[model samples]
Target: MEYDYHCTVCRGHLRIGNKLVFSAKTRDNKYGLIFLSPELGDYTTEHHPDFDIQEGEEYLFYCPICHARLNHTENEKLVRIFMVDEKGAEYEIFFSGIAGEKCTYRMRDKEKEELGPDSEKYRQYFDLPDEYRKYL
Candidate 1:
């Protein structure tokens, strides 16, 4: 099944087909959608000469179409991303990733009974696998 991500604020596409299919590098020197992976994981990023992050800097991931910030706020770890499952159900995913550390991810879902109308389905991450959970 294929899942997709869109910017809730601007309705912009962020991901498609296991890639960062959309891209944006603004005049303000900001880059778009960074999908950080494990040390040896196979992932793709645009190698633009003007796009470079110095040592000890947080990566910036903005929407390619609207340039809205995804992934995080300045100095904030938690990131809220908008996603759609294969069935076309929308969800708001919240997670955290620290700079220079291996990324972490979990898959789980639950009832939205208590949430208000504006809230879509919320899935709290299930316990990660032993290898991933051990380090947390």
Candidate 2:
């Protein structure tokens, strides 16, 4: 699917992708998983949402710092992104920034740990935007 997403800060073309699965731990130490596509935008559901990920569909998940393309198959376990509520009391893990930011928490003991590679814990540290942050 094609979209017209642009970065609000730089007006650069915001890359699009199919979010196959969003698995992370909640603030209460519970695991959660969500599956959806960007084409559906904000109307995602718990099962078989309006958006679908076709076989062999290419999705781009980029780095927040340099905006680089990430390789999902090889770097899935390395990177992660989390979203924290306004109260700072609730949070969730959304994306693992494996090939991009170099999370140290999740990928501890690895050669290059950005923030330890923990998805939920990383969200607690980074001040991510609400919309994009929720998908990770």
Candidate 3:
């Protein structure tokens, strides 16, 4: 399944080839370009060796196009982006920004789909409202 990723702020295309590139700032203030797999549930990442990222460390992500911060308002540990399928239906995509954390959520309307082993770690933030839960 192919999906296109975009920056939520500027709606700029983020998927380049097989990677979604973003500007990242480490907790210690180190900055670098981070390449992440476009595949949902795939946590593989590529970056310069000099741009060291430590596991369990939270990093700030930004859009390379508009340079807008991608951190989700509900949870800073997760980065928000827009994902459009071939049908042109757009959905909100949220993924972990903490190194080595594998959690992702794809949400549309009041529906949601979780992907990754650590997805439950942030499940509470993505849960539908009590009124909507009855329909689920």
Among these predictions, the greatest TM-score belongs to 3
lDDT of 3 at 135: 39
Residues 1-136, candidate 3, lDDT per residue (tens digit)?
A: 7899999989999999999999999878999999999999989999999999899999999999999999876568889999999999999999999999998999899689999999998787667565553332
Candidate 1 structure quality by residue, lDDT tens digits, 1-136: 5667777578666665566443433345676435432211222244446556343354545566776666544323434556677898877644432233333332235422222231222212223333443233
Better of 2 and 3 by TM-score: 3
For all candidates in order, the CA lDDT equals 0.46, 0.34, 0.90
Quick one: ranking by lDDT, best first? 3, 1, 2
Which residues of candidate 3, in runs, are more than 4 Å off? 128-136
What lDDT is reached at residue 61 by model 1? 54
Rate residue 34 of model 2 by lDDT: 41
Which residues of candidate 2, in runs, are more than 4 Å off? 1-53, 56-58, 63-65, 68-79, 90-92, 95-136
User: Which segments of candidate 1 are over 4 A away from where they belong?
Assistant: 21-46, 54-56, 71-75, 95-99, 104-136
Determine which window of 10 residues in candidate 3 has minimal summed lDDT.
127-136
Position 126, candidate 1: lDDT: 29
